[model samples]
Target: MFVRSLNNESQLLRKIAEGDQHAFKIIYDYHRRAVYARAIFLLKSEVLAEEVLQEVMLKLWQSAGKLTDETNLGAYLTTLTRNRSFQILRRRVLEAKTEIELRKDWTESHNETEEGILLADTQKILADGIALLPPQQKMVYELCRVDGLKYEQAAQCMNLSVETVKSYMKLALRSLRSYMKSHTDLAVILIILKII
Candidate 1:
């Protein structure tokens, strides 16, 4: 019975790969709840889990053509969810560490006037860079980086998944770095800001 069920799933995958939207919907309906439950269990955040669910489904749709009969859909989706969750966690840790290092460096610097001037300039550049971000990214960056909210807090405030928050922070930092690099000699300050 187990092997038969596997065979049926494989057939469904094959049909999905052949551009059968009906098969895809069937598979989605069958798996989405379990996938969502797993994501919530692993991430402990409904918002992030929902985001993961959407991302996982989008991946399934985009990669349906590449799935072979041997592909284990459950395992594939599970692994994707786990990987994405870990990625968000890792980014949060790195951001925290960078923030700590920046604070320490800033506090220990003796050249207060020079550092102040540079920071003021960097803040202006940052504001300009932030203006270029999409609204969601800008809000996420402000809540997490500017307002010093934890990921969970920011997620709650923004009504976003932690993963989505992290993704926005990543994009915002990338935009800031590109902008700062091009506009000023504050490359060192940019490094200190380290939005990665």
Candidate 2:
């Protein structure tokens, strides 16, 4: 049975490499849920996870010609998904909002000043901390917080159950807490960790 499945997958992969859109769609539809699950796991945001899934699929299609074997297609796809998801998370961290006080440093008639540069550095730190969160936690947290989706909504979007979403969110919070411990106070951490 396993061998037959493997053969079928190999044939599908060969068809995909030959620029068969239907074959690519079959492969994508089969793996889309797993890709989203991984993205949600790493990113803590449903919206971002969805975005990552799209990006991953697009890249996969573009690189179909390079798929040599299907015996480990899942692993290869997972690696690609992880790399892209991390990229999104890292970009989010690098672009975190500035501290309110720092924002005051910028004027309508803006001046490029040393303070602006320092503010940018702080934003980068916040972004890095966010990027450090475990993949699943990041997706759940982001969906709830950044995207303002309720747990149920987020879960639906991620093709996960509400309980699973809650579980993921809990795990994400714990991991983020640990990751950001050095940079946060108890009160602020509590605020961020609050499940809504």
Candidate 3:
């Protein structure tokens, strides 16, 4: 029975690689819930899980032409979903940590009367500074810092080359640093530096 199942998977994969929609549909139907569960387990967010599911299946379709054989189909798909789920989970965690640290700094550094005001002021100034950045630089920086995307992942999301993403990030940091240096006070400067 196990050998028969293996053979069936192999045949399905071959047809999938040859661009058979029914074969692809079978794979999708067989694996979609497992993939969703994997993403949800790692990401802990339904929205993120759904997004990961779409992303993983899209990647499977795109790479179907390169899939080598049926013997590895289950392993390959499982690994791919797991990896992508972990990646998204890690990014969310990093973003949450950064947000917590930023809030902690804001709270500890200022007394009650001034702390809220200072934080609000700084947030506005930072928003304005971000607005001044060039479109590509702003995008790269926001995706990395706010969305917690790594450079390579942001590049993929933006459909830009990785090298281009790196370049945009460098320029974005330079621009942000220059803007902050020109406009911010010492405490806000420290916070911005820490966040970056």
Candidate 4:
């Protein structure tokens, strides 16, 4: 019975690969609830789970050509949903941590004139570090980190490959860290910048 089910899925996948919208819809109807349930279980938010479901299904449709006869469709969808949910959770945690750190810094510096001077100095150092980056790296860092763009969006904006954007971002971060370590006494600022 299991083998028969796998065979049926393989047939549907092949049809989907061939651009059969009907086959895609059939598979979507079959799996949408399962995907949504898994996403909700993992993410604990209905809105986010729905978004994940849409994203996962879109990816499935786009990558259908890569599916093979040996693929277990249910397992594949489950894994994708789980991974994406975890990614969102991780991002939310990081954002919360960054916000808390920022709030702590703001509270500490609320009334200290010296803190204002230090912040100005840190900004100058950061500006200098940004100025020193290679042009491509600077663009990537600014787009993805400063402007809050996703890697894919940055790649599109720059007409570069996603991997290249990622590489440039990595290099840019290393350069900034090195510059900060060498020239600044602002360790907390460095940690905050690193989060960005």
Candidate 5:
């Protein structure tokens, strides 16, 4: 029985070396369990283990012509599984180290300039909001808010009565408040992406 099995395996390997898909499928069915079991046991992650299994199978097919009658299939798969598992573990360690270093640098940079960045963002949003006002409202906002002029001063500069300037200022403030509120989410997203 053992001799018959050896002959079967040798024949399957020979056919796989000639690029026979049916032979490769049979070999895959016979060996996939050992490959997957070893990978899952070592990696402790089903997803990564499945990845290793596919990689090993692909390697096996690619290197099928190297197989000889005396080659031990189980041991060959074991070596491949162990090597690939270690590679994943090494990559994970490297990623963790990189993440830590990046976080440290980002935190330091953010701490030093976070307030300035936020103030700039707010000013931009406020400027955009002001630009959305009607021509008269926009003029009133620039004169009163941007230039720091009192309502009466703005009124004289625009050649209008004090009451009319006050009314325009109120309308501009209300419109700007609504515009700023609507744009808050966009500003927040920009800030978060920049920080990250």
Candidate 6:
């Protein structure tokens, strides 16, 4: 029975690589439950698991040409799903840690009203500064800083070199700092810097 299933998967993979939607659908239907189960088990968030399901399947379809006869479909999918889930988990942890640190800094200094006023002023100045950045620099800032994407990921998204992304981020920071300094007091600039 396992042999039969392996042969079936191989044939479907071949058809999928050849861009046969019917065969791809067949395989998706056959394997999606297992993939979703693995994702949900690891992620423990249905929405995030659903996102992983989409990402893994999209990667599968895009890399179908690389699927060899020796590839164990079940193991390959499980590994992919697991890796994606862990990637998301790591990002979440990083974001949460950053948020906690920022809140700690904020709470240590002022009351809630003061914190809110300072945050708003800092955000406005930062927004104005970002608006002044050049196009590539703005994109780099948004991707790397605001979106919390890694430089490599932002480079891939922008189709630029990683070095270029880093350079843009640096320049963007300098420009934002100069702009913020011109617009607000040192304290406001420092608040924005903490968030950045």
If scored against the real structure, what TM-score would every candidate get? Answer: 0.50, 0.48, 0.61, 0.53, 0.53, 0.59
Which candidate wins on lDDT? 6
Q: Count clashing pairs, candidate 5.
A: 0
What's the distance in Å from true for residue 150, model 1? 21
Off by over 4 Å in 4: 1-7, 108-196
1-196: candidate 4 lDDT, tens digit per residue: 0112434788889898889989989888888888999999989999788778877987898898998888888888988998999999999999999999988777443447866677677777878999999999999999877776778767868999989999999999999888877886665565447453
Model 1 residue runs over 4 Å out of place are: 1-7, 108-196
lDDT of 2 by residue, 1-196 (tens): 0111334677787787788989888888888888899989999988788877777777777776777664477777789889998887877776664545466775667345854664555455456766877777778888887777778678867989989999988887666556556775564444444422
Worst lDDT 10-window in candidate 2: 1-10
The per-prediction tally of clashing pairs is: 0, 16, 0, 0, 0, 0
Which 10-residue window of candidate 4 scores lowest in summed lDDT?
1-10
The order of the candidates by TM-score, greatest first, is 3, 6, 5, 4, 1, 2
Q: Name the candidate that leads on TM-score.
A: 3
Local distance difference test values of all predictions, in order: 0.77, 0.72, 0.77, 0.83, 0.79, 0.83
Q: How big is the positional error of residue 106 in model 5, measured in Å on the Cα after superposition?
A: 1.4
Better of 1 and 6 by lDDT: 6
lDDT of model 6 at residue 82?
91
Candidate 6 ranges beyond 4 A from true positions = 1-41, 44-69, 87-109
What is the lDDT, from 0 to 100, of the residue 48 in candidate 4? Answer: 84
Tell me the tens digit of each residue's lDDT in model 3 across 169-188. Answer: 99988887888778889987
lDDT of 6: 0.83
Q: Please estimate how well model 1 matches the true structure, expressed as its whole-model Cα lDDT.
A: 0.77
TM-score of 6: 0.59
> TM-score: which is higher, 5 or 6?
6
Q: Please list all clashing residue pairs in model 1, or write none if there are none.
A: none
Report the lDDT tens digits of candidate 5 across residue range 1-196. 0112334877888899899989989888888888898889889998788778878887888888898888887788789889999999999999999999988777443453876777678778877777788999899888876666667667857999989999998898887767766777765645534421
| TM-score: the better of candidates 1 and 4 | 4
lDDT of 3 at 196: 62
